[model samples]
Target: MKYDDFMGEVQHRLELPDTGRAVRATRAVLQSLGERLQAGEAEDLAASLPMEVDYYLESADSGQRFDYDEFVGKVADRANVDRSDAAYYAKAVFGLVSELVSAGEIEQVRAQLPDDYEDLFALIDAEEVEE
Candidate 1:
């Protein structure tokens, strides 16, 4: 997806008031997700994303072995939102990412995370099931 489309999708998904909030959610979720993935896997995933958001994954300190709760906490802190909103933001962002990224890369990312992180991809899975 292009940068504008990516940002617009994020804004629509999160129902945010403006581009600024969408940027925050995208940065927070992508950065937090990147940290959880290995450097190579993160880079591979980053390769498929838009220019504006890809660096969030490319520049993360990968191999940080935080669980899903900590993952949500980090996103909440980074996005300056509550934990609940952070989780929602993550689901929304990941849902969009699943479309832009290839299936093999998605499997790589899924393999890196534990089952608890499945909630993050709730929308992705649901859409797949319907199709």
Candidate 2:
């Protein structure tokens, strides 16, 4: 979902009065994020993005995993921000595109243990070796 929509839904869920000032605040936050992302400042992004999502999510539902669409709708409604903005924010947070790419190193060394690996301990036969 767009950033505006996400903020709007969050605002709505939180029961914040939807007003012009609230909408402006949402836009300003999103615009600032865009600027940061454009600068390729990844560390800063990692630190801030999740915190924002967590704050909004917690404030809205007090620790619940609402559907992406539902959260977006509520935020959009509350913040009076455009749905497009909410969509943008959702894409950034939930799209998983960035994670998939950045986490390539971890994907490279991937391995799956055989189910029989657990049997190795039983097969050690320590008693037989001593005898």
Candidate 3:
């Protein structure tokens, strides 16, 4: 999706007040996801995203191992939001990503992350069940 459309969807889905918050939350989730994936996997994922969003993946530090809590903490730190809010933002962004990206790619991401990360993708699972 185009950056504007992507952010608009994010803002709407999360019911955020403005684009700035959506952009921040998107960056937070993308950057955290980039850190979680291998460098090659991150690059592959970036290839499918908008340039603005892709920048976060490209700029991230890959090969860093972290669990779900740390993932949320990193998003919170980067987004400059509270930890609880970060979780909500991450889930919103990730849910959007799961819809936009290829299922195989999403599966690849799931493979790299720990089991706890599954909770963040719960929306994706719910969507599948509905389908």
Instruction: Please report the candidate that would top lDDT against the real structure.
Output: 1
Rank list by TM-score: 1, 3, 2
Please, what is the TM-score per model? 0.97, 0.27, 0.95
What tens digits encode model 2's per-residue C-alpha lDDT throughout 1-131?
44456556545533456644444444433333332222223332233344443233223222233343554554455445676665543333322223323333212211111233222112123323666
List where candidate 1 sits over 4 angstroms from the true fold: none
In candidate 3, position 56 carries an lDDT of 88
Residue 127 lDDT in model 3? 89
Candidate 3 weakest ten by summed lDDT: 92-101
TM-score of 3: 0.95
* Cα lDDT of model 3 by residue, 1-131, tens digit: 99999999999998999999899899999999898899988888788888998898878998789899999999999889999999988888988887778999989988888899988888888989998
Go through the candidates in order and give the C-alpha RMSD of each one to the true structure: 0.7, 18.7, 1.0
- Model 2 worst lDDT window (10 residues): 105-114
Alpha carbon deviation, residue 12, candidate 2 (Å)? 25
Model 2 misplaced regions, further than 4 Å = 1-60, 93-131
**What are the lDDT scores of the predictions, listed in order?**
0.93, 0.37, 0.89
